[model samples]
Target: MARFVKEIMSPAVVALRPDASLVEAAQLMRAQDVGDVLVAQDGVLLGVITDRDIALRAVAEGLDPLTVSCQSVCTPDPVCVGPEEEITTAQRLMRDHAVRRLPVVDGRGTVGVVTIGDVVQDRDPDSALAHISRATPDL
Candidate 1:
């Protein structure tokens, strides 16, 4: 059977309200051991917040994380993928957007996130993406 996004996705999502403070978002990231968090409103995805967003938009800007809202730093209207989409389509979307992660949505709204790492992990061991994704990051 052909692979699909939902078939390999982690199904673990860490999300927060847009009004949530950057500090709270950071706390959630820490607690969840995730690099990104979805900013949602009433179960609708509004944006995405990554550690990079906090670092560049808040910390580097000298803004107080506790006082600032995640909505202020998040990438608004982020690209998203459906659970039923083909993995190749997901990969193409990632490459086209130059983003490492894409929120997975369906009729139920945001369900999970699909990261390049997730894709790489799910790919065949002999696949080029798997080998490339497995490379260690520099300290």
Candidate 2:
């Protein structure tokens, strides 16, 4: 079982500048096969934008994705966890924030992302969510 966030986190953090367009962020997500992207500038953590944010906040509102900036729609100052933090602490933060993912930060910057799926997989590999998390994403 993973004892810390760094143990189970997906270390490849897909990030974009805050000025990046929603379309660009969406495209990045598609290319990365990730559901979310960290909005940053100069290696500073800014916000988090998710696929649902693009769909519900922009597309559903009839806003042009090309014109909408990620910073304008992203959840700003998102709750984060340290890479060295205990796995249970990450789980608690996720539960409290009602967020599915958390940015794993260290002194350097955002290093990774820990998702509920990661926690589930680490804590209970035989669970349905764990099984689903391990499955290959559909194209």
TM-score per prediction, in order, is 0.88, 0.96
Model 2 deviation from the true structure expressed as Cα RMSD, one decimal place: 1.2
lDDT, candidate 2, 26-139, per-residue tens: 999999989999999999999999999999999999999999999999999999999999999999999999999999999999999999999999999999999998898888
Highest lDDT, which number? 2
Segments of candidate 1 deviating more than 4 angstroms: 124-139
Alpha-carbon RMSD to native, per candidate? 2.9, 1.2
The lDDT per prediction is 0.89, 0.96
Candidate 2: clashing residue pairs, number: 0
Clash count list over all predictions? 0, 0
Among these predictions, the greatest TM-score belongs to 2
Residue pair clashes in candidate 2? none
Candidate 1 lDDT over 21-112, as tens digits, reads 99999899888777899999888899999999999999999999999999999999999999999988888999999999999999998888
